[model samples]
Target: MKKLLTFSKQAVLIAVPISLVISIYVNSLVTILFLLVFLPDLIKNFKKNNFSKNRKVFFVFSAFVLVYLIGIAIDILYGTANFRKSERLLPFILFPLFLLFSDALTVFEDKKTPLKIFGIFVLCFNLFLLVNLFTQTVVEYNDNSLSNKRWKKSNIKILENSKERYALFPVSEIHIADVASRPDLLMERSFKFSRDTLITRSVYVKSNDDVWLLLRQFDGNRHEGAWFHPKTARVGFVQKNITADIQKLENGWSRISVTNRVAKKANRERLQITFVDENKQYDVKGNVEYQLYVGGTQLEIGDSPSDYMPLQHRNFLEGFDRTTILNVVEGHPTYYSLFILISVLIIILFFRSGYVQFLGLVLNLVMLVLLGSKAAILTFFILLFLVLCFNFKNRDSRLKLLYVVIPLSIIAILSFSNTLNRFNQSLSSVTEKNDVVYLSTDKRIEMWKSVIDLPLLNLVLGNGNRHGYELLESSTALTLNSHNQYLEAVLCSGFIGLILLLFFVVGIFFVDFSARNNQLLILFVVLVGFNLFFENLLNRQWGIVFVAFFLSYIYKLGEVNE
Candidate 1:
């Protein structure tokens, strides 16, 4: 029976890692199947062994999970169970399975190398996936490509959501409103040259086929524009053209240009644009609540005072994968998943060589950067600089000094540069905000004031993760996320949960500092700390990835021999 049991352990132990790897990088359903695969082992262990020795980790982790649930229960009781909020409770479902898998890893592995190897592979796999994206030569993006076709199944919804119609006229990005000029009067789609010239008549045209439109002023000069959406179907909200009028023109150009209102104080209401023929009958109908055409530019009609969809949370992930692919191609972030994986693997080597402190600092920095959280980065740098100035050898302050100065300099430069604001105005075409000033500081202030009214316990429990939205519902800030991880800690878990979380955070640093490896600890501290500022780390996929990777690294079970 003992031999049989050992055999059982061995068989399942080997399978778990394979299963986890497959599940994580491959399929959504695999996570569940992998978790379920080890149930028999978990049950048998629970029946046969007493969990006293390692219960402290389990107890602390479990209490954290439980208190989080109780907070959710309170939310549900208040009739506020939402998809975004409810998903925050997912760790409740995942942790037990994680524990079981952790036990399996602890039970069967003798060498620490496999864990490191797995980390390396995870990095490699992610790199591979993203690299394929960068090349774009891969047919998957091509409508005819098979691998690309397979992903169509995965991305149907995303594609549908991010869908934008191409426009016939090249849009002039908004620069500024010129209130100095008088409105040139002309017939619809007609162009007037100066005060008396009729350069061209506004031509109303529609087509079942795609076509580009050209405008000519009375002076016989021509301007060109393309119609992006020509063919229209009723199933989707696509732009349709009924008429193009260059009614009034002065000299060789039309005096009237398109402008969209970004700061409309009107109580919001859903509006739809319908096209009418000369017969005055509605020919086509499309919802304008989400879209507006100011002259030739398209603008998003966001939630205003009277018109709001409570559950219509912004889906930032809408174009994330595609955007990331573009970024990879452009070499923006520089280090892809493979880089991170390899970096982690390299640090693992340092661990084996017993350079634990340096490993800690490196890990901290890498994690902080990858998280892309600016606040966390700023905080970590400040703390690192203060500590380094007071202690540690000055031998390699070069890289550390660069780290502290670079981001701050960028922020400073952007703040003083009106060019940056003009660029933002051009991209977003939000005419109301003349410049793209550094707005993060203002947003942070608003986020703080939103939750200041909550009771101490409510603040401690965080009203439940993402519950900041509900708690700060009355604030004019438009949204709530302390954007500060420390603040999020006080908000999500009550003070108890915050304390436990802080304990875990402090534990990681202590492990690094006690081990005398400042590098590794600083790496994570900077990365996680910085990212938590601009993002609700737990609420985003990238954030979750950081969290998972950090958790795996810090809480790694000591290897055991079979």
Candidate 2:
């Protein structure tokens, strides 16, 4: 009988580690095990017990969950029973109850064993996500390539240039917003040139039939540009000193460039792309499709110094697979981004960075940017700056140089990517519905207004999760959720429950308030709190597991040390 109990204990503990990644059944099963394993013991402990530091933390953790439990009870008393909504939240109450039982029964010499096992599982899980992303990226890349899509899946923009109208342009990247600027731009299918510099127009083309292309600029009756046969490499210019070059790209696509050498004479501003052999060799409907590029000594664009150190042709590391191939496994890019942020936090707090940890940090940062949750990205950098500065005085000169250089260097490169535009959009204020590009930060401000507008009764004691969500849905018709965990917590649990949740988290600081522990504790608390402001993490299974497991486990790690 003792051996059977021990075996069951081992299986239950194993489930806890994987609870965060897998099904809601495993997570909720923690509660069933609690019922089977600790119901009688819990009743006894309730009858007579002392509040140890660990137990106190457990009470706070359980209270946060019980707010929902009690809310569900309030719900059932008025209507038919439905633990259905709150059942998934069982891990919070039950995991702590299980912890309480393990301590009471003296299950193991090291109570931290399960948490230690859970930590190892977290590392494996994160690594798996990275590897899974690699596989997904390859599959997506092949899909993107083979589809031969003329334009990207983002923003639904169509091809505009008339120069090459019959051929299909290469498949556009739909992986991330890496190509956000190129296709989304209100840019005309033409290039401009200055009076004193050469102007070059390059087009990447795939042809459906034979065609002659003409580039003409009609600036107040002065027509100055060139015409060329894409099939025969034949060229004619209305002006002197014009040049053209063609290069072959992969998969039947070719790059053709037309350059005006005497731009001062041409003063070319507006470019008109028309096929010369529209009716002769090809139909007037157009004969080629292409992605166009313009560069030279022109003011609108500029050339590279050398072929090797060429102009910034794409977003930061655009040719790489990491940016293009990944779509997150978690619910949203925001959730996955927050996961990476926490992963970086874990690495910094627990692991020593030689090269491996450094690489892990870099990988997380890259994933963070690609995921492109503005809040997560901003939160990550803030965490880095604060955590590094928290121990700035203790670091050696060498490490100090690295500390200062690292973020600056990252920002320098990242600035060139679409991340900067994302940041700018995040910063911009939205005064109208049309301006809400991403439901960015300002949209969050609009969402938060609904919180203030919540009914007084709902504000005091929330109308239960299900009804409260309906009310919030009505209140925030523009969005899905309130987008703030605290606000949503208030909506579900009421104002009093919000206070309980706050105490539940803030108590971690006072649980082991000392010099040795304060720094890491500060990082954990602030990071979680900051994220909760922007995301309704407490509402989701993945977010619930993250908050319940890590917050409890790390808090216990601190308490045990004391």
Candidate 3:
């Protein structure tokens, strides 16, 4: 019977790490599997003999579960928490319960073994995500290249036709031809002398095709523009150098020079020119139009430089694989990158190879930078600096210099690039531009302010679990949750609940610190605490899973070491 129980316990413990790794890449089905795997452990805990030996640790872990239960009670009493919101908070209850009861921690003689296993899974997943990103970037680049080639071909056709029509017209005498012979050639003119002048004319092309064209006049001003069909508006083109020299040849043809400015905003494939000859005005029109024809789809030339750069650089090293990874993972890269970094750090600390630790540290920094979350990157650097400072005494000179050099090099590169500028712009956009509704930081600030100004009752007991969204929507007409977990806690369960949650987290830290001076736990708390300031960590399944699993694992490791 004891053998069977031990076998079952070992099986479930091994499954947990496997499920966690699968859950990170796969869908919620894997997450369900993760939960189900803990069931046997929960059942084992129910058997009287399976209770954890560390009663204090169990109670402290259980406190987090109690805090959420109280919030649920408050929500039920106030009728504010619904099934949907209650589902999100289920992890708060479930994870703590799982940690408190599971025999997995006791199964590992050296708890760092399981941690190392989990870290290996995380690193492997990170590599998988990186591969996915590179593949997507290559595919996207090919698509863009095809699109650009089509656009260029269509543009060249229009320029060629315009040049051909202009060459046919005489410099001494210009005559307006009938539209029946060549309806596409709208205007053509030859000049006796080159003088800067602008010629403006509106020409209408009748086609449902989305066409892009290059309009070049006889002088030398050309404009690239696009034309959308089904609109009866006249598209205009300008030639900006109709000279002022008049030459009367032996024939009854005279070349007159006139300068005019072309309208920059016009989009037309052809131009209609009206030139004044003495007292007579000659009207000439060209019907040369270029149609976009690429893979049976029409192309346009309005893609802005700002839009193109990101698309081009996304496949490159600087803006690497975030979108691709996000598409697969369905969560922000910031969170996943943090997960990877934490995993790498765990390996570095516990794996016990100086060279390996240094390599992992460098990789962590690179991954964080590539992830491109300003807060995550900043938090990582700060934590790294602290780690260096705290471990300064124990480290040899080489390791110390390596730590300093790696981070400094990454920081210097980031500073020299537009990544830092964009991060600053994002910050400035939030604080300086209050009118921008799309800025997430601005919205978070507004939500925080609104929550702070809630009625005294709500302030004391919180509005209720998941009530923050409705409350924010009501107050600000914006449907958003408290992005900050600290604010979310206070908003959901009030100051009392917030205090309980904090106590649970602080309790874990102090308990672990007292049992064993595990520096990793301190770093874990720091990472999690910093993340809470920007994200509602507990509200997210990934966040909850990450925090709960690591905290429990670290605490268990501390218990074993003690």
Misplaced by over 4 Å in model 3 are 1-55, 62-71, 88-90, 93-102, 106-109, 145-321, 396-402, 409-418, 430-433, 510-516
**lDDT by residue for model 3 (329-436), tens:** 456776776676577567656766666666566556555565666667767666767677667787454446446655564675465343454365466656484553
Which pairs of residues have clashing backbones in candidate 2? 164-288, 165-288, 166-288, 167-288
lDDT per model vs. reference: 0.37, 0.53, 0.52
lDDT tens readout by residue for model 1, 1-562:
8667655555543433333434434323443454565566667777766755334444433333454565565566557655444454454345433552345454443534444555545454445544564354333222211122222221111122222222332211111122222111111111111222111122222233221222211111122211222223111121222113222322222212111232212111111222222122222222211111112211123222222121111332111222234232232221232234334433433344434424434444443343333344345446555455544565543335435444654554354322233234334433344232224444555566555666876875556544546666555435556765556656655676567655544444443333234444344545554455445555543344345433433343321221
Query: Which of 1 and 3 is ahead in TM-score?
Result: 3
Q: Where does model 2 exceed 4 Å of error?
A: 1-19, 22-51, 69-83, 100-331, 389-413, 429-443, 455-458, 510-518
lDDT at 47 for candidate 3? 81
**TM-score for all models, in order of appearance:** 0.49, 0.57, 0.64
Worst 10 residues of 2 by lDDT: 182-191
The candidate that wins on TM-score is 3
**Compared with the true structure, what per-residue lDDT tens digits does model 2 show for residues 1-562?**
9878766666665565465445555656663664576556567766665646557667767667766765565556546346665655666776666555344324546655554454445455556666766564344322312132211232322333334322343332111112222122111211223454544554444443355555544322244556555554445443555555666555445555555543322212343444434322211333323333221111124453223221112332332322232333324566556556666665565554445456556666665665566777777778878777776776533334336446754685466444554565455444344333233565577677777788788788766766666665676566477788788667767887788778766865555455236555567677778888888777777777667766665565555556
What C-alpha lDDT, on a 0 to 100 scale, does residue 464 get in candidate 2? 70
Using lDDT as the measure, the top candidate is 2
